[model samples]
Target: MSDIQPRRSYVPPAVRATSEWSWRLLLIVAGVLAAAVALQTVSEIVVPLAIAVLLAAMLAPITQRLARVMPAGAAAGLTVLGTILLVSGLFTLVGTQFSNGFSDLTTQVATGIEQVRDWVRTTFRITDSQFDAYFDQIKDSVGKSGNLGDTATAVGLTATHFVAGIFIALFSLFFFLYDGPHIWGWVTGLFPRAARARVASSGAIAWEQLSAFVRATIIVALVDAVGIASGAAILKVPFAFAIGVLVFILAFIPIVGALLSGSVAVLLALVAHGPGVALIMLAVVVGVQQLEAHVLQPFLLGRAVSVHPLAVILAIAAGSILAGIVGALTAVPLAAVVNAVGKHLFAGESKGEIEQELEENADKDPLARR
Candidate 1:
């Protein structure tokens, strides 16, 4: 009876398929986690290189035009220099404005603080002793967090890291602008000969997507800056120019940037004038944001990048969690590039069909042709 053997259990096809998928899914997740760990481990180099790539994408068209007349190396250098100068000029302007107006602004803020304290005292019945006790508690909590020496050491290390990152970014940007095609070719060469063409095609799609994202973001950011700055001016808010500059810079980071800069403007108005003016300033900020969200972003960025708002939000959140402000600033563009490359690689189109579509798109967009 034992020698005859029991019949083997028959597994359903659905169960078999599930078993196959379960391990593959686990492997995929494991690979992703491994890659993330590796990236984080070398983030000092990786982050700067990533920034260079983005800067290269944004400056590529300009570099190309410059290259037509000058050498590629020279063009890249000049482009980088120009970018540095532009940023420096903006900083100088903001600094000058802030310096000129800071004293008056501080006076206004001090008076406003007194008014706010009086209101709080009257409304909440919080006495001076209670306020002092609250402040002392806050100070004690902060003191317990770390000593002055530890805090200074952290600041020094951060500054050193920042400076190193700047140099790395600049060096990489030069090479990326001057030898982008050669670098990309070398990267593809790492793959098998049969897959090199496919890799190159995907890269092209990714570059196009990145370029489009950069262009659209610039326009959207400009519109936001102008809209908010104009509102501040119309409301006669103090430091309107500073607010505009700050907003323009912050607008580079999606979603959160505009909200933060707008809040600053609102706070300034409140401190300089009163709640009445601050309320109007807030309405203006909200109106401008509505226009940006509904009109400019949808019309410009939606068409150019073709990424969903939900995806953008999620990317920003993940990036912020992973890499802080730099991560948030870069998250959308990275997502756009990945989305485009993934679609091209996995769209199931034949080689000829893909080439034909790319050709058609190139004809429409001069930048894509390159």
Candidate 2:
């Protein structure tokens, strides 16, 4: 009985060697891990590349128009040079204003602190002895824990990192402008022959969407900065130009950026002028933000890369959590590109599924029969 049972079932050696599903699952896990590592590496490298691409894309249309009359190489060169000059000039102007503003702020802060102390003593009937004791404690603590050298070193390190980042970014931008198209072609070619066409098409569409988003964002940021600057100037805010530059930079962050920048403007106004002026500055910020949300965004960004506000917020939050300020700055643009691609690739399948579900529901519903 045992001998007969032993010969009953035969399993092929090939079949027993490995399970297809198990192999597939292992591959999937490996692929996921590889992708995660790749994304981390690419994010670091691609940030500057993305910035350069955005800049190039914004300039491309103008360069193309110029190419109609002049040589393409020359057109690209002229465009890049002009952009550099413009950026340098703007930064120079802002730097000058910032220096002056900082000096004035230092003086104002000293005076403001004195005035506040005097007011507190007179209004609250506080004695000078009480304030002197507080100051003495503060001085003793500060003297024991003096960190002026450490603070200066930390500032120097920050400045060094910033300069290095800027250099890398600019270098990336140069190459991006010069060889971006060729690089795109090479990248697409690396895919399988059957997939190359689709990949190329998708890449082109993504670039288009990214370019549009970048251009629109720049315009919006400029408008917001100018509006805030004008308002701050009117309110006699110290460091108006520096605050305006801050606004411009933050405006790229989407919904929350404007609020933060506006708050800074308001605070500066409050310190420099008064509460009444600060309130007026806040109103100006609100009005500008509203105009941007309703008018500028719709018109400038258009429908090409439109993403839902919820999705934008989620992306921003995720980005901030993952990579701090850089992540937050890049999140919306990444989301826009992802959204564009998702709609492009999956829209038909999603629509088909929806239709099929509806048909099945209708078949089951008594009211549909009626």
Candidate 3:
């Protein structure tokens, strides 16, 4: 009885492979779920910090240039002040437009409502009593739904949160622009020395991609604004410039943003002008987007942070689902950084190879050199 042979259980190759893939897939899903939960849990802090990082990335170059000719403090202060002024001016402009348009917009909306009512009455042959009953039902439903005071309180709370986030963003932005290099070095230094170069190099690549994307986006957004605004103006749309500004701001979010903002513009055109102008405005929006998709992005961005359109859409959708608009705004940049970092680690490229690749990329855009 010394040794009844122990039976060996063998997994087929396909079964083994399936088991391996199953655990890996499960691990990835679990990681994503954990990250999403963590992000949601600390959204108050993370949103502002993420926004500050983006602002710092955009303004760092200007700060650096200004620093060359002035003290770091003065340079940073100037950059921050300049950004504040620019943002203030934009808000002020939009407010003025809104104030100027509000009364007319209300009037047009009322008239549109009347027209629709008239059409419905004619089409359906509904009596005044029936329409009145409908309105009463709607009023009853509204009254039953919730209290006005509660809605007001919710709005006030949101405003308070916004103000606090703004303060956080500004406070973080100043430090980021001023001590960014030192902070980055300190961060990378925390990694083991053996892999420091690769980490640093990868970060540099991500930064380069971010800067290029930002610059290209700004340029594309401006062109989109001008093109659409000009059309709106020609079509005699109310709040034309304001619509353009909204488009410019939203354009930073890429494909879906443009479509949404453009749709708003078109709707306003329909309300303020007419169906004809609205149709023309819609065409203008589509044309400009086409130009952006084909010509501007490829030419200006130059494959630096070229995530696919489908990837962009998916990232935005996922981000919005996870963290609302802040997530949406940060999604593309996060995607670009991830893509760059992955490429930087994709092959076992040496330091020289990485530097050479970066040099070649930089050569594609003269602005990238500095």
Candidate 4:
């Protein structure tokens, strides 16, 4: 009798095609395009939802812990209430300081500008004739402008758009806080059964990374605000409290925001005191920024998520390119989520098969290893 060997089962062309490299690439491209379209269509909806989700994730652990003692719904409600109160108090304080400072700031700035112009004219020997020519050109340009009614209409339209955006953001935040988790579950349910596990896992990882990023950012911003506020107070800078609040808010935008806030602070110092005070304020800003970048950031955010500086800069640029200010604001947290998920997925796949096999064998026979 001839020795017989069993025939191996073969995959049909269609089956192979589904798992081919080209097919995978096409699927990935399709998914990305779909995401881009959805993002564009729902950007106004997405911005506030994203913010609420990040806030919810950051507060979730606290709520969960409180839920063990109280009810989950009550815990969540209390958390939201506390957050509202905190924000309200901060805003009220900042507003009061801003109102007190604004009038004086405006007057001082005007006076300072005039003083500098006079000093320049005296030192540089610039004549009234030269100034007249400049003013004449400015007047001619203004005369050539469109109708004042049209300008007013444009301004009114811009104000309307701004108000509408704020309303949309607030509405979205309410739904996201109350029903975001349920919505996420519903979304995952739409995926195929085989892919649902992966989707859920990725979502959880992304949410966790986003929470970490938000918390880290808040800490950094608070530190910056406190540091700058202290410096301003010591230097007797006008609008110290208001400037601190502005720094706290602007610090959310990272490198660029810090520089802008610092510049404003320096300008204020220049107007309030003199160039010497302005230089000192500039040095203070530089010192605080250096400390934040080298010490505070590494200690606080380094372990939370390890994103490259270049990647962050690029992500901010891309966000600005796509959605302007809103895009820039949201970019880093999104990038952090992407980075965390990418690391988790690719890191597991990169391990050698022999190690995996050995691990599997060890699991199968605990006594065999000994």
Candidate 5:
């Protein structure tokens, strides 16, 4: 052969480079899909662990402050207890509001239903007998499907999962708070020796991102809840306290959750008052949301969790498609953490730059400073 067969195919350097990249990209994609499948299979544990991590991030500053005065275990315990008490108090308040308002709500709903029925009958020219027949048909179709037992089984399983998840979250949160550094060190130790330092740096960046996100989210949610609840109270909406609590809880899930929960307030207003009050309630909800979007989020989140609005929407959509409500709730924070960590790893910032970044994060959160 004349010294390597005279370049048999004459493949260009650009074409050869592209061919090399194409396979590597496909392999990476395949690996990602495989990982996703694995995660889904163990989602029960994964979900609880993820929740614990977020909760730990939220409680970390408090725990750290307490740790300065006491043992880490005690600090973690006290923090967890305080969180439980606060949550229980909220639930109790919501329950009391619900109990007090239920009778009036029922009356309003009944009256509204009657009015709707009358309007429907008049407009559609439907007789009572026709309505009864339609309802009977619906009942017959449901009975024919024979899914009641299956539905019951599904509900029971869901209840079990919920209880289990709660326990797992609590246990993981305790350990994460008490032994966070050791745990992280152990995890980083699992990597190859050469990668240990970079992995630890990436983890630190991720944790900072998560903490900033949780803190900002808490502030934003509180503001949203207070704003909406105050509007409801001013309008004399039924179960105003309950609506506020519900909004506080739902606002954690970002845009969709607030809208859905706000719609509940709107529906209650429509039933209890009328379309006039309901429209006013709707305006209040929209106004509060606008304030959050334009003012509060920008000031609170800043550059710490700087995910774009389009990315947020897309992440929410993808998460909802994958795992319903839980996925949607977690998607944004997860995306932000991933983005921050990915940037850190790829850019390989100098020690001074990393220290500067940490300083900036700490400046944003007063609790973060030693």
Candidate 6:
């Protein structure tokens, strides 16, 4: 008793937690900021590689199957060739149709605009002066924009960047499909010998998660596209198939993407069909999206990624802020895979157990090529 100091509660539980998490949260933010800076610094190289990785993950099962039937290199080449052809065909079809029908579409749109104007004037009792004032405001805003030459230069640069990104993605896709295992093995080899197995296991788990996420997303997208497109077709909407394709592609971007694509379809319908058809299209969009949000996504992606909705929203927001469209597209899958791998490692699962779990996952994988 003589030697012991009087016991005292110097730390309040609330204060202690606040202090403890404050520093940890700060550190996490700092680390994330540093990583973001580094990524932006090497965006050109990183963007293509990241896209290739996701595409490679999507095509991995097919690649593996094709490899068994043929040489790995030839299989990868063929897969890449097929993807290129598919994309080119889509673009060609869209461009040709757009070019051929643009003038007619423009005329129809002009007529639709007049109809809208007349309806607005009649419904709201708006005068010519009010309409002219609004139109003048729009004209003033457009007139204040940059010169045509600057716009053309900007467009040219954008097109050049697009072409370069495409080439890089394609080149990386072939190598990733053909030599991804070897590349990953080499990467793991760089780690200390004892840690290599854990690293390899974690990577395998991440890949499985990636594959599962992509495949489930693809399926859900197809379902949404079909559902919405069928409704549009029943409404006898023009370019229904094209709108379906657009919806399918945009559905990759998650919540916002599908909504925007559906809105586009609705607008087109309103212009080409009428208010009744547009209303029907609107109901179709809402119904399909609700089904996706309530049923397919939760069942499929929940099983695959196990990410909370809040986490998905946060990831998408952070990704869009960090890397715009590409980031938004990749964010959810990346977060899910990282979450899976981190949870696996942090749970102290042994490398042996990881391999077993991964094998089980692969066996049950929906997209696994039989």
What's the TM-score of each model vs. the native?
Answer: 0.90, 0.73, 0.87, 0.75, 0.86, 0.87
Error of 2 at 172 (Å): 2.9
RMSD of 2: 10.9
Residue-wise lDDT of candidate 3 within 115-179, one digit each (tens)?
65676688889878999999999999988988899999999998998899899998888888777
**Full-model lDDT, candidate 5:** 0.84
Candidates in order have lDDT scores of 0.83, 0.75, 0.83, 0.74, 0.84, 0.83
**Model 3 — TM-score against the truth?**
0.87
Top-scoring candidate (TM-score): 1
Across 199-300, the per-residue lDDT of candidate 6 in tens digits comes to 767777788889888899899989988998898889867677778788888787787788789999899877875565688899999999999999998988
Candidate 1 wrong stretches, greater than 4 Å: 1-3, 10-13, 118-130, 236-238, 356-370
- Give me the runs in candidate 4 sitting further than 4 Å from their true place: 1-38, 118-180, 348-370
lDDT of 5 by residue, 135-211 (tens): 99999997898678898999999999989988999999998888877787788789998776566667777887888
Best by lDDT: 5
Instruction: State candidate 5's TM-score.
Output: 0.86
Give lDDT for model 2.
Answer: 0.75
| lDDT digits (tens) for residues 21-103 of candidate 1 | 99999999999889878887888898899899888878988988998999989999999999999988988988898899888
Q: How many backbone clashes does candidate 4 have?
A: 0
Give the residue spans of candidate 3 off by over 4 A: 112-150, 351-370
Q: Where is model 1 poorest over a 10-residue stretch in terms of lDDT?
A: 361-370
Worst 10 residues of 4 by lDDT: 361-370
Task: Extract clashing residue pairs from model 5.
Answer: none
Q: Model 2 over residues 1-370: C-alpha lDDT tens digits?
A: 4555445687777775667767988999999678756766665555555566666767766666776798766767777788889888879988888776788887776765666667678889888999999999999998887589998998999677667666667666655555566666678779998665455555655776777787899899999999999988877788778778899989889998988899999877766655567689999999999999999999998788889999989999977866568778888988998888777666554445544543553322211211
lDDT over C-alpha atoms for residue 25 of model 2: 89
- Writing each residue's lDDT as its tens digit, candidate 4 over 1-370 gives 8699888999999878878978889999999889877887866666655666666656766665776798656766777778778888988998888788888878777876666567668989987789889889999999889899999999999677666766665555444444556766788789998666555566666766677677888888888888888898898788788788889877877787798889988888887766677789999999999988999888887866778879889988877776767778788888888998887667654335424443453322211121
Q: Is candidate 5 or candidate 6 better by lDDT?
A: 5
Error of 6 at 141 (Å): 1.6
Query: Over the full model, what C-alpha lDDT does candidate 3 score relative to the true structure?
Result: 0.83
Better of 2 and 3 by lDDT: 3
Q: Give candidates' CA RMSD values in order.
A: 2.6, 10.9, 3.5, 9.9, 3.8, 3.8
Return the lDDT, model 4, position 105.
Answer: 73
